[model samples]
Target chain A: MTEAHSQRPGVEIEFRSVTKTYPGQDTPAIDNLSLTVPAGDICCLVGPSGGGKTTAMKLVNRLIDFNEGEILIGGSGVRDVDITALRRDIGYVIQQVGLFPHMTIEANIGVVPRLLGWSADRIKARAVELLDLVRLDQNFAKRYPSQLSGGQQQRVGLARALAVDPPVMLMDEPFGALDPITRNEIQDEFLKLQNEIAKTVIFVTHDIDEAIKMGDRIAVLRQGGVLAQYGTADELLGSPADEYVADFVGADRGLKRLSLRLMRDLVKVSGENHAAPADAPTVKGSATLRTGLSVLFASGSRVLKVTHDDDSATVIGTVTLDQLQDAVYETAPKAPTDVVVAGEA
Target chain B: MSFPTQVIPNFSGPNCAGQFFCWDWVGANWFSVLQPALIQHIWISALAVLFGLVISIAAALYAVRNSWFEKGFSALATFLYTVPALAFFLLMVPITGLNVGTVLIGLTGYTLLLLFANTVTGLRAAPPETIAAADGMGLTRNQVLFKVQLPLALPSIMAGIRIAVVTVISLETVAAQVVQAGLGTPLFNAQRNVFTTGLITTGLLAIALALVADALVVQLQKLVTPWVQARR
Candidate 1:
């Protein structure tokens, strides 16, 4: 309970120097890693396979035990709580979906509720409501996992995890198995669902672009449970911590940063009513940095003013090649706003 | 019951007990001699098969849970089955001293070998995913035994029953040698009397009983496993 007050408003999870080592293993899967996830925020744990991202996420739910230190849910130590009771209060979604093949979608989603001893009628209603929330028709509740498409089955998996109305959600590559189009759709649907539910979520993924799009805070992990970097998407992209972080972001860091720097991040420098200069380039405010770069190239300017497409055009902001380069190549800044202003051309 | 005094020469042709007999005897005593033969044969075979199945299932389940016991049980069943039918009955005579109980014990022992092997194989064949799914559902061990593994292994277990039923029919004849009466005793006596037509009639009756019983088993299988049929 004392930890709850320390967690900023809406924060529900805290992991304190947790470590786990299996017998006969030379190195621990997670080695003294600590992180606090505030409530109502998407904190993505991103790293390549074998990194401790999944281990860190699982510790919050106590799916795996920690050898040292502790994990807390809503300020209570996970170790002190009963496992089944704890799991019922925290939602978990895996990449495989792990849907019960023999049960209908409704029964699958209602599993936690049934375990919690809810009345039969209430469980059924909740199952239907969850199905609808996931964008599936109520009629499909009776269908088995095989009857639903992979995306639909994954949606049902999410619904099942959310059935008990847990305050914390841990998702491990939830969309990793789907085709691109379906993955994007599920991600968008999840975001909408999260906005309404506002659960403190720890989402794990290896995809940097996905982390940028879906995470409010991204924790990049290295092998051996090392913390490569932990910051907002803009901070991570505009300023990686070291060569390891930069390399993990890959060689196309410039392009990756373009997607991370939203128009709002560069909005303060807009020169209102300023007539367009002959050498200046123009880009739509909504355009990504990659697209903005094309406009800058055609006009041969270092800076581009981003404007609304409406007839009564609104000046949103200005961006430059230096800011783009800073976001693409700079190290983790002590303060993100400082880099935003200093990096401006 | 001794078959109603066979009206010899009235049923079979002029020579009375010749090799090629007439159908007259079958029509005359169909309700008496034939009915008891059908009832007694069916009773012994059904009871033996059921007893064998119950024993096999318990043994198989125990084996599944303990690898150490499996080898010993497998050896025991094999040893019991190797004793020839007549020898098995003759061995039982001293213990039970000649009665239906002795006949049942001998047939039950003979059927165990077939049932035990099939049952072990069937339970082992249960899909790993099915077991994992049940575990994930939090079903208790007994629920898993009766609900998941038992139903999944039903077909293989049923095949074992079929094999046991056929074996019981043949073994029950040997069992009759230890008892005062059975379908086998009448045939055995007729062969000694050199009444060849009587031999032919009992042989035909046993074969007919086997055919009918096997057909009923097939029917029961279809009824029990409609899901398999639907899948096919």
Candidate 2:
């Protein structure tokens, strides 16, 4: 059974003209949606409540079935696969974390594996490996979910989803219930974790900033479940499809775009004449341009030294506000009239 | 009064008789009749509750899947509960005869309302998010019912069972009228013969039995649901 779904690099998810309408509702919840999440990419579906963002995600796992059209996982129609087997192969994490209260962390994480009838020793080994993957202490495996903090519970939720090492994962506002500080902290850790695993992920959220921060590609849905735009984060922010997309992305589109670029990407090679000033604030090369900009403002300095730590902290270059601004514009050129025409048409 | 030697009917020291209290009568009859009655009472009540739980859980699982069934079954259970216990036993006697069967049928009917209603309520009370999570993770309908929903509903279900057990214990005493067993037999016999000692002792024992059953069920609930204790 395990060999049947032996880990592929990542599976692509395709939604072809799919629609969902709840009983007795005149309008469909998901209206003729067509989108694709490429292999090994995180595609975020974001919109206001009642926009069918969640409905679209549920259709992937068939938690709820679609009314029309096909939802394909790796080119095979979802209807063709045994649903339980399909679900076991696709990881799912939710905002509430739904860790079984009666079960210990180890048992909760090993649910899918146990359901697949893996050996006891194999399940225990998998649980230990997952706890470490989620950056949790191994001792946590023996504790119940009630003993953990909210953020910790969410990590356990992720570990449980990843138990079978499924090539695809569906996350519905996974960090939506946490405090802002914890949410930010988890988001950073989550991005770092994603880099190592690289599962094909379909992330659903109402928060656009979170989408911008996490999505490799984004599908913006409107209230009637219509797809407003499907593009890269920079494309959506650089040139929104229409007024709704523009307003939805918010007024600070430029600053949001700055978050997409790293400080290392913008750093200028320091000439011999330009030595780092003693008062200049130093930023790690891996920091975001947004962080670099914030540091520049707080320190009230036009220039800041950027460093990369190999064995020791070595100053690599200096970055200026003008340089940061140039980097943002360079990536997101002013939208041509033709670009808006292409979006609207 | 200057009465004959036998006139007072042995009203002397601890052997008092015909003195509205009779220790001598109680001592002689306690093991011979009352001990078996107590044991029969416990056995009948335990069986009734066990049967009621099995039937109720099955009905609750069915009811949860269909709203129409839930409404209809709840109405039927309420109707059964409203019938007087004596009337139900008498009604069952025509089909089941004046045996333990008649007594158990009546007692089990009384337990059904609490067990069925609470089982349904407990299952429906499971968090929607938890149910969705279970489904999304590939739990089949049956697996979800047994593994996820049932375990979470245990506390509410246990409370219902505790009430049902205690209620059945008391109701079983009344079964002695038709079945010829249980504590009610001694009380009924004492009433006919005007034996005050037998009546009070049997009544007190029944009450004590019910209290012990309720306490034991409470302990079982606490033991099974460690998570609820941790929350507090």
Candidates' RMSD to native = 6.7, 5.9
lDDT tens per residue, model 1, A1-345: 222211222456887888888789999988888888777778999987889888888777665778999888788898888766776777778787777544577877887677678999988878877877888998887776767788998998888777777777788898999999999999888877676777788999999878877887889999888788888776776677989987877777667666654444554433333444645766776566667777777878877777775631565666776666654555554354422321121
Per-residue lDDT for A276-296 in model 2, tens only?
687789888777778889999
| Residue pairs in clash, model 2 | none
Report lDDT (Cα) of residue B188, candidate 2.
78
Clashes found in each candidate (C-alpha, N, C closer than 3 A): 3, 0
Judging by lDDT against the true structure, name the best candidate.
2
Question: What TM-score number comes out for model 1?
Answer: 0.73
Model 1 C-alpha lDDT per residue in residues B11-34, reported as the tens digit of each score: 332334444675656665566565
Q: Which residue pairs of candidate 1 clash?
A: A10-A39, A11-A39, A238-A327
Q: What DockQ does each candidate score versus the true complex, computed on alpha carbons?
A: 0.12, 0.49
